[model samples]
Target chain A: MTKLMIKEREVVVPGDIIAEGMNYLPSTGTYRQGQHIMASRMGIMRLEGKVVKIIPLAGKYLPRRGDVIIGKIIDVNIMAWRVETNSAYSAMLSVKDGTSSFVRRGADLTRIYAIGDYIITKIINVTSQKLVDLTMRGPGLKKLDGGRIIKVTPTKVPRIIGKEGSMVVMIKSLTNCDIMVGQNGIVWIKGEPKDEILAVETIRKIEDESHVSGLTDKIKNFLESAKR
Target chain B: MAYKKRSDGRKFDELRPIEAKLGVIARADGSAYFKIGNTEAYAAVYGPRDLYPRFLQNPEKGVLRCSYGMMAFAGSGDRVRPGPSRRSTEISTVTQRALSPVIDLDEFPNAVVDVYIQLSQTDAGSRCAGICAASMALADAGIVMKDMVAAVAVGKIDKTMIVDLDYEEEAFEGEVADIPIAIIPSSGEYTLLQMDGRIEKEDLMKALELGKEVCKKIVKIQRETIRENFKRSEK
Candidate 1:
């Protein structure tokens, strides 16, 4: 009989001593290690009693009823243009929701904001059916273009942005880049060609290591190195 | 009349190259997405946690709830309503039933297991496929289950039983008689059963018989897909 040596949720590694006298088969994700320790049934190298997934977190940008989001105009109809939010659902931008200024005759909506243009907007309503309504007349709501876009793990956006944009501002100052972090994980970075590359790489590294402890200091040190 | 045939001239019953990805949604406790040709479905599992309300609580066993929905642009035609409809409600209920048999609900008494299934594309047998995908997602989430469940549709075309049906074939006369089933191949148990048109009892039996064979094939692929997904996730 193999001995029961670990408690529930104990973190085990590829060769962590598992059962010593227990007749149990290791489930998936577990491998016998060096005739002593055994791999865990789940991901993450375990230490005490916590199973670690250690994978990038994933989820659709779920738009809270009243959160701001930056979106892109994908289509335009007579009454409204469809804006793809960084969420599971898209939003409708009504003519009324746009600026009140109007024109004389058959005014082309494209003249106001053509397709492929990004706008910072606020989600006014989200129905149970997943219909989203948007309004553009708000602080920091406007058009954006001319910069390239990159995506990151949606859950990591908050971490990458940090508290009150401090992390982002720091990155901007160090890399000398214009950066916009969208709530949907779509980041728009524009700067000198070399600076842009550095900024993006830094952001990607932040995303990959967000789950680890002491990321802010690591990022600070990275920025210092990049500056030199 | 077969509405549309593949470039290879295979009948509608022929399933496209199938693939599945487990643990696709990181935030969800367990999640998987699968594709049969272009038709895609995503399933996520959450729970064995606290029951939200007393009314929803089960004393002897845990309650299993399944929500099946489709994205607005899931089809090639036009955008659909993103919310729940009558058809979705029915599918959700049937899916719950299909999953309950395979889950050891008694182990998590007073808790609730919620499965959310989203069809990113719509073809025939999506509901059946959706249930199968959800079961795999539940397993990925580390939720305990008796066994994996698999699903597929057996449509009759040209007076012969065909294993998996596509959209256009769904409306054809011969295909209309088809039945979609969800089963646990290991235990030989039925989780779901539905049909629209009339066929002989023998044909129905034959479809079930043939369905079992197809279900086994689906189960093998589902296992392989989950293994591949986990491996990819590590990298």
Candidate 2:
């Protein structure tokens, strides 16, 4: 007989037994061990049908194709610019894909995206070597200016953004801060100095309380109180 | 048996009170503090970031490096010279090997995961404590692992086999055998096995059995610390 040893959404660390017997299937952050399905990392366990997956609550960001990530420009050569995407591997934004407008050969790329500058880019390719290729031609993809960037845990990003971006919209509407949250866990905020600080604080709070149920209402209350 | 009563008054199969905490160092990617008896160890994990000295990079997967150190005043007697000593290097190598089998770093090609374990105090079993702390630190960093590793030094003093040997027991004026070992809880496999002195084969097997039992208790404490850390962060 198959048995589930852990309740759904239960927190589990590596090697924790989630289920026993062959009725269950293992998914992300989980693996099969003989007759048991075990957690392979620290995370919240979720059950979907017969599949068991552990959603990681911690760890560094891993880049994926089609993810619109915010990255810091770290290097510039004649052909491409190297962007640090808050991960172990950096991405390349070549001259041809850097901008919609034609960039002539031997052009001064520093004028476009210099080192120490932050930009929102879309991942175009991720090769087997973990090498990444990025593009800045998409709508809303460009260099960010004057706004301070803060990082949250990448895995908690969905909660910060909320369903259809309701959570971030709430923070912006209340704090009057223009905020853009990147999938890579980088958040850029620009507004009145006080509003920017409030926005950053509120986002960090969400990251911390992401595991708590009914968090949206709690955040709403938090914003309402912070306004006074 | 000349060794009738333990100097510390602990039973032969007893371990000292242990305390464990995670994310103790704010600057580190993952950090843990583990103390057993009077010996305390702090381990910090960094990187999976870029691996420098290009030649050292492993294109297939990330490299795991462990460095074990002790402060000059960490031990009794003369002030120990600071920096990497022969004994520290040997312990560091073994520590890395003990932890590598459990972690999967295939996703981080050409990167490196560095674990630094520093002991601020000592009784005995410093290396084992360091290994335990390092294991937790790696997991706290979100490194996927097959299982958590727990360690304890089990040995024989005179004719008595003991679970955890303190400094006094180590320096006991008798035929003593000190075996420091690390165990993977779920699989019940030994990742670390080193011994000093000598014991009869029968007694050695009994000592290992005792150590595995003590390690399960240590693993319970380590896992609880991680769970508690998340609970505190939720608020």
Best by lDDT: 2
Candidate 1: list runs displaced more than 4 Å: A1-228, B1-8, B11-13, B173-175, B233-235
lDDT of 2 by residue, B1-235 (tens): 4999998888889899999999899888789999999999999998778888999899998899999999889998678788888999999999998999889998889888999999999999999999989988988888888789999999998888898899999998879999999999999999999999999999999998999999999999998899888878776
Estimate, for each residue in A1-228, the C-alpha lDDT of model 1 and write its tens digit. Answer: 455455543332222345543354454444333333353222333333232222224333556677777789999877677898765456799888866687435577888777888887788897654568988888877777666678776668877888888789989989888888877678888899899989999999887666556777889999898778
Model 2 chain A weakest lDDT span, ten residues long: A99-108
Clashing pairs in 1: A1-A21, A2-A21, A2-A22, A3-A20, A3-A21, A3-A22, A11-A46, A12-A46, A16-A37, A17-A37
lDDT per residue (tens digit) for residues A28-80 in model 2: 99989899998889888999999999888778888899999999999998889
| RMSD to true structure for each model, in Å | 13.9, 1.1
**Model number with the top DockQ:** 2
Residue range with the least summed lDDT across 10 consecutive positions in model 1 chain B: B226-235
Q: Model 2 chain B, TM?
A: 0.98
DockQ of 2: 0.78
Model 1 / residue A44 / CA error / Å: 12
